[model samples]
Target chain A: MISSIGILTSWLLFLLLALVFITNNLLKINIYVRLIVFLNVCLFLLLEIGLFFDDFTVSYISNYSASTTPPLYKFASLWGALDGSILLWNLTLSLFMYFYLKNFKINTSNVDIKIYSSILFFFVGYTIFSSSPFAGCIEANEIGCNLSTLLPFQDLVSSQIGRGPNPLLQNHPLMAIHPPFLYIGYVGMSAPFVASVSRLVLKETSSEWVNVAQKLTFIPWLFLTIGISLGAVWSYEVLGWGGYWAWDPVENVSFIPWLLSTAFLHSAKVTKHNNSLLNWNYVLVGLMFLSTLFGTFITRSGVLISVHAFSNGTIGTYLLIGMLIFSLLFLYIGSINRRYFISSEKLKNKFGRSGFFIANNILLFSSAIVVFIGTIYPLFYETIFSRQITIGRNYFDVLVGPILLLLIFLMIFSIKLSIKNINLKKLYEDNIIFINSSLLISIIFLMLFNRSFNLVVTISISFILISLITLNIIKNFNKKGNSSYWAGQIAHLGLGVLAIGIILNFTQSFSQEIEINSFDNFIFSENNYQIYDIVQENLPEKTELKLPISNGKITKFTSLNIFNNSSQQAISSPAIFRNLIKDSYISIKSINNNTFKLIVRENFGISIIWIGLFITSTSFLPKLKLRK
Target chain B: MKSKKFSLILIIILIFLSFYKISNESRFEKWSKILLCPVCQGEVIYDSPSEYASDMKDILQEQIKTGYTDEQIYNFWVTRYGERIVTDNIARNFEIILIPIAIISIFIIIFLRKINAKK
Candidate 1:
């Protein structure tokens, strides 16, 4: 019965969205938007209710939730799978549209509503047709049927049991919150996309759209940063890999859009200030939105192998076709409206602030292109050469590394330069003290502690960046107002800190495999580690092995969980002991009759990365509040 | 003028320092990163905790101990498990390297031309 209600609500939402495009004149757009939002809320609530009640009659609940499942897992199971995540996606899109329309004055001729509603219409229609969570399942099948398969209501009634959530997802609490933040970040790009498209289509030449686009991009960019950071934290704490980012295809897809949105944010600032890079802003915003769609395509489609991808399906082909159609439509509109993209004022000085912004955009955009190609190259290579090849961390480190270095350089100098003036002499004089001090510190530090050439370069660059940004902040400390300037500087300082952490962690981290008997002590890297106890806990559906290890100062517990489900999967959760300078990470590789093999790694400067990410993400809060 | 000269001298010193190359990774660390875990999805042998990855690491260590060259060890893996086993193929492929360089250079040229055109 609840499954039927879900399907009906989705269909109602789809029809209401379609009415915005079909019957444009019959009802007000606000009425249609209201109906769509209401139906989306209803659909979302219906799924939540189904999961909460353990309604085995609904296939989604039966597949993901069991009677013994915790209430939190049951709630998170709504977005734990492919079909339900799309439902969450639709609900997020509707909420964004409802709130945006409430604040902005969108007119009848404004293609913003139409474009926005059409995106909603496409997702709602996709939920109904391609992958509906409301589909029923059969009980007798040994393995559960494909999730997207729609069965009769009579068949679902026969199934009274559920398989429970994906053991990997329910293993940690981070899984529940990570996907929501990421989805909000992904769906939030549609706002600027719709605004950019409508602005191009209507040929509006005012700078008002720039403000709207910047504000829209800034909020999503903050969420994307937080989401990606949380995902890294989850990967480190949960995956037992002793590392955060793996350059996996899914991670790259999400990061690709972020790179574009960040570039757009920078270029949009230039356009607002100097009325330049107008055309670039439009294209960047458009790409930012489309890349989100492409990200969804890569995640849902089984073409690329990713640790984070859902099960393979035909939904990928449909999403690709949809992406192609949208790209073509955007190209069509952009080409016909090319003349309006031309800015009245050209960049007059190569050494001015706008010049640095332009260079920053180039480097960022090129890095995005490099990542996008590296991600999809294997698919192309497989098709043509009939061989499978993996593009891993080495590929990105080589190609995108130099570009990032150049961007960091630009970030430091761009702050000191004026918008329209070219004054290298005065700039040098102003920053000479900072430059000398940073160079001196870098030289001394490298002489004392550097292990490799890369470490030396990274240490030197970070010192320069941090010192320069601090110099800026100190110079501007007593001056009132310009909170935006302070925010940007703080964000840059955070990036510097994050860069230092990443490089230090990468260079200095070492792991060793050691076999230790119970209650035995081992020595690694001059730190003595002793295993205190190994405790096994029996839960309703799983067995967990918790190992407590101490390094004479602190004890941390690392665990391995073996699920009692049909798949019988096992996941190991690493324990990290963090301090002001570094983190001591330990994970269980395997266990044999009271003997445990542990991978103990000393991760240097990891705490600094989290602190940096915190400072950077919160810097946007003041800017966001000022937007209001 | 003094600050400009100091900056130029500093740049030269930095450039000269960057050319001093040293090997930071051991043979085991390097080879473990280049080879993928046969059973895991896109994970290197060094990072994966699976039985197969551990076995691969053992074989690699044995090869290194037997006085095998890097090329000989890499070839042994390629023969055993095709070209897909190597995780650094994109870095080794010369044709793929040119594309990104060309794209970045083109962007730089366009940006420089736009700025120069104004003057």
Candidate 2:
């Protein structure tokens, strides 16, 4: 108990000093002070185990006792609930904060770094004060609840039997790695914000920070790519949403940051080359930070009525307020720095890459804003007008589609230009034959397909992917030092694959709602389902039903499970989902007998998405060599 | 000197054109983002892909090309679906709180920056 208390205490202290770390104008403390603070935070987390396991006659342990919960869950419980998850976010933020500080070159004493570090500190501190997971369930003791009740089944299992992790979390191998990877992407926006803060606070009238920001920018974008991909994979095989992206607010939340960061990544390059888009870079990074804040708010705040946003509370309000304050501060600073921007660049052309960047940012922000308002509109309506409103896929698809086509066109052409001016006449003279031939081929392919417009969209987008692949392949030319390029290519290709999947799945998916008793599979689309084969006997903690899905050509089955254990099952029916790129969604929603419901959707292009993700995931391993 | 003048003139023309196109596209995207999808109740008009949504988007595109302010476009939708159609239930209160909050926070930050500048 004492040991765990120590761990909790260290994080509390770390969280408290966060503001001092981020805002140098308030307190420009020594770098060592922040470092010591985080060191203590890490120590506290380590100490928590003792308090957790001790058979103490204490407040938290008596209710959430070590005896009732699984040890794995007990450990995982650090982020399993509201208070604990907040603590987890703070801990992660603290870890990143310390690491970021430690990584700085000792001699590089730029004054803006104070505010940069302070931002990280403030974020961590607010997270601790507002939402700490290391909060001992001391309040449980205030009511004299059973210690067993304190430690839910999973936590008890964590104490005794090492119950498999949350069956939903355990369903696919991707589940294990997805969330941590996402947190990296979500929090990694700090790097660019740090750079942007330098631009704002120190008035570093140089492009060097943009260069630094660019070099580091791809990292979070890449992680976010993987996270979104893995999330889709998780959903396809689990949520039984049949499709990967449900346009769910949570899914859109992830995509919004990805879009902003992507715009930032691209715009930063323009700034890197021509010293143009300095102002745009500020906007992009600020937007990226806001997206992260908004995503946290959406996921945490119950204001949004999405199944995910249903987890709303005072913590949500605190987070939303935190996000609003953070956004306003950054926005204000960015506006103030308007004078320092490389304003009125003389080299921009009306219909070139700069235009592309501008259009892309607008579209990206538009996408994020639409999502932001839609996600929160329900709560606002309820509070202001005493009316409840629900917004769904109808709200998103209309606006996002045409912009996607526009983006695809931009992607195809934007990369071929740079600062010293493209000798367009000379390049056109050189590549006219190539460009004309490609355009002709695309036209012919579309004409032949009869759905020429859709073909145009797909072909142009695919060409962009192909062009990027060819360019990178040629540019790197078997180079070992080009891991960044390799990562970019893999990620770009992943986007292409995802896009193709989206188009094909939308155009070609077949689904049927089926009622099944212990042994029947309903046939739909290009596949046959033989039921009864997927049901597996109860595991130690839960019961599972597997659906074997097979196209006559390929035999693959997805399994679904209903967690029956009283300790394991609670709030919502969380299921284990595996995306074999074939079929199988293991859901805990079914209660058993004739009443079980499963919507089996057979999709054709899902595998393209899987393959795309696999390629991207493979790229991550090769990067161990690039660690320096 | 003649060549420099020509190049500078060309650059200005190109930059203006780029800015023009960007501004135009951004307007359409901005207005589209705020519009509610008729088919998908909670989603934005931009991210939806249904038939009704695509038709509405086409109309929105026409409005943008023809030059409609965001408020005008919003009003058009509001007239069609009532005021609930224009602002999301969440953003309705959002504008009221968001404006004051943005103002206050901006003021505070500016004040701080100024104070620091003095010290």
Among these predicted structures, which one has the highest TM-score? 1
DockQ of model 1, rounded to 2 decimals: 0.41
Q: Give fnat of each prediction, in order.
A: 0.36, 0.00
Which has the greatest lDDT?
Answer: 1
Compared with the true structure, what per-residue lDDT tens digits does model 2 show for residues A20-92? 4454442244444465456555644543463356433332333232333445544554443344445455555
Q: Kindly report which residue stretches of model 1 are placed more than 4 angstroms away from their true locations once superposed.
A: A23-27, A139-155, A158-160, A474-483, A566-569, A624-628, B1-24, B110-119
What TM-score do all the candidates reach, one by one? 0.94, 0.69
TM-score of 1: 0.94
RMSD (Å) of each candidate, 1 decimal: 2.7, 11.2
Q: What C-alpha lDDT does candidate 1 achieve relative to the native structure?
A: 0.79
Candidate 2 has a DockQ of 0.03
